[model samples]
Target: MKFNFLAKEKNTVVNYENAVAFPLTPDYELYAAVVTTSLNASFYEKDTTRLERIKDLIQKSNPVFVAKLAVYARNEMHMRSVPLVLIVELAKIYSGDSLISKMITQVIQRADEITELLAYYQMANERNGVKKLNRLSKQIQKGLANSFNKFDEYQFAKYNRDGAVKLKDALFLVHLKAKDEAQQVLFNKIVNDALQTPYTWETELSKVGQLKYYNEAEKQKAFTQKWEELIDSNKIGYMALLRNLRNIVEANVSRYHISKVCDYLSNEKAVANSKQLPFRFLAAYRELKELNSKYVPMILDALEEAVMASAQNIKGFDVSTSVVIACDVSGSMQKNISPKSKIMLYDIGLMLGMLLQSRCKDVVSGMFGDRWKIINMPKRAILSNVNEYYKREGEVGYSTNGYLVLEDLIKRNEIVDKVMLFTDVQMWNSNMTKDSFAYSWNRYKAIAPNAKLYLFDLAGYGQTPINVEKNDVYLIAGWSDKVFDVLNALDDKNSALNYINRIEL
Candidate 1:
């Protein structure tokens, strides 16, 4: 009496899309969840549920793997909050040794993260009511205490803001001993709130904001001058420059300063050191485009160059390898990555899709919702190509009918070497037919046996649209440009878990 037909596949699950798919292994799921999240609620999953899911995954995963994943997410992916969350959640379950402390030291790159880690620690442990710090995780405290040695007076003063757990509270909780007489003096200043105000972009902008202006024209003049000063001083960091480009342009800064800004924007070394995701340049470009300022073209050109710099390391296919890149433009994909962010999930898809398309010598790129349509595109102008796609997204209906891509390929009897789908992975059949992505992929495999499917999981909902293990499929997650490195690794027959495992703890 064999009942094997009724049994589901060993690693399969019904996803949020209500499609039969493979669940990521504990380590894979953890990596995907950490890299793709900012701890905000997604269209398909709430922040609380995602938090619980991560906690459960961390408990299921090995402690050392979790630690390395945190470092990888922070150092490689440039993620901020979730790495701290991973460490905090890991602390609650694993109490072996200096692993947690070492992780905190590795992940906390900025002075503010010290307080952020403490705040998250307080919230995660439900210790808000009990203010005594004696029961706090000693390893975390040791890590924070050691981290104190890395900052100076300006770094500490810049982040000493009042919160549920302030910097002063963290200093007290960690019981950090001063490293030297000078360090002891700095500690006193931190405790007494006597640290000097660090010169920064915010302070500079505030000074300009306070100047009395008699009229709109006068205010614009003042702002323009201030922006020029900020640009000349080099006090504004790269991220600050990107975020305030619109303000700088609207203020009508001089051509000298604008050119200076463009130079900084396009500098390969600066862009690399910024560690910003490629979509950030796209976001900045979109904002400037809406203004229709004369400088828009200049900034757009700079952004195009900047994005290419960010994607310089992406390993794409040559002419010998035919490629098709399909981006998901479903209604769900239109949801914002964060509540206040103008950038949506689909933006990441189009950005990454265009980036891949730029590298491929022979490629077919398009968007898919209820149907898949191929759009011929040039290899250059990566950001502008993304813009073109964003403007025409409505041409396709709003539904997560991703299987239509493979079905289209099968209908055309195409022998594409690589098929890339940049999507949220909540793919389902819009018409409720028996045909699914898995079915179409299987049929296409018969004709193109060497074909590979790469799913760029932007939303990281923790499910593949198809069973990755049973097919020639690779699941890559994260909104960072480093995610492309996973593609090259996969080409070498390596999995994402293997990529994370190779990270040195």
Candidate 2:
């Protein structure tokens, strides 16, 4: 069967060691097993062989059997497994390892209210990182606090998993740049320690994981003492909060979960006495509507901005740049170095697609590997949280004939002036595209010889060099500040127009 990331939606849920949702007397052993298995990178990267060897030893009834499969696939990509990422994300969601997952809970709670809230949180957080605004906006971010991480007592704190952070608390702290692979590894260790130290799912985290850790349970508990604080702050649902947070970061967040949002709101209303005004009536009612209204449009804006920003030096182009975004939909594109990295890229695709459409309808968005078609309308809308605008879609393809897709688009008459291909740049020729470079560009030359190519290096999987100055192929690094600056700076029309008015129009 063709791998479709969107197809996994049917199985997603919360509060589980497995597929079960929030078991009241939850199986701690199951939770323990799932947690231990996910944290061990060696278990994920090189454990497939070990798992296969122990399959007979670790029966289906054995906790380790599932562990064997999940770990081997997760780190090693032994199974070339797409499901492993899902499992890890679920583990993080239910157990609460990362703050992003926690912040995203808002959207999960109310799919509709996600847009502006997420935008505000993200903007505030980003601004928090730099000395920009004279005053920081106080948008409460317990939004992610519902899926609170549980820290072990201080004696074992360094070896514990710290609880998740609030959206504002986690702001730009999510990323850390390093001078080299060693520093990167060091950074990862410190950051990981902070995330997992006080609450080790099953084991102690490395030194690098300590960079972002703090023991402030007193403050958090004191702050979230009442449920009213959670609701008023918009931290009502785990997924809803996380979705909003992700949207802010321009990370691919899940839909608002309209059905889930309504479900929660309905249940909350059910629990209240509404003879006059229901106790939680206003909160529940408003959250549902907000989830529905804000989600899609916010997503559209975030995606559009992200895609535009992910590209380099486009803000001031005197001419409108036409973009044909050709991406890889192969099963492997779902593969990620880490959960954050993968989510960020997926978010990047949507954000950019939306941005291109608004910035210029002249832009077209599509995915290809073995073949090509635009995600064009998500192909079909799947609303969640009464407010969701779109949902992730499942599609099919498995080869990188990006060269051909590009060539075909160029061969058409009313040509685009520029083509921005957001892909990993791993195009190997088959029986057809043996001379992809010549055939593709030659055809492009026939149509719009002046056209330029801007290669968006999503995740840096591309090994081929495209000299920006020489070939007009400007490349932007994924998950870097350059991604943001280039897109924002592309064209600042305000001051530019002010300069052109020799006499006012």
Cα TM-score per model: 0.95, 0.38
Candidate 2 Cα outliers beyond 4 Å, as residue runs: 1-225, 230-319, 337-347, 378-396, 465-468, 480-484, 487-505
- Per-residue lDDT for 1-505 in model 1, tens only? 2467456565577877677877888888887888888788888889888888999999999899999999999999998999999999999998978999999988888999998988888777766455734577889988998888899998998888887777788889899888789999998998888999988878877987888889988888887887888899987889999999999998888888889999999999999899998788888998888896788888889988888877677875666989889999999898888887888998999998988888888789899998888887777799888888988978989888889999889888989888999998888887999988888899999999999998888887788868674567888889888888878888536687788888775
- lDDT score, residue 132, model 1? 39
- For model 2, how does the per-residue alpha-carbon lDDT over 321-388 read when each residue is reduced to its tens digit? 66676655544344543443323233343444333443444566767656667654431121221112
C-alpha displacement of 276 in model 1, angstroms? 0.7
Q: Against the true structure, whose TM-score is highest?
A: 1
**How much is 480 displaced in model 1, in angstroms?**
0.8
Worst 10 residues of 2 by lDDT: 16-25
Q: Every model's Cα RMSD, please?
A: 1.9, 22.0
Candidate 1 CA-lDDT value: 0.86
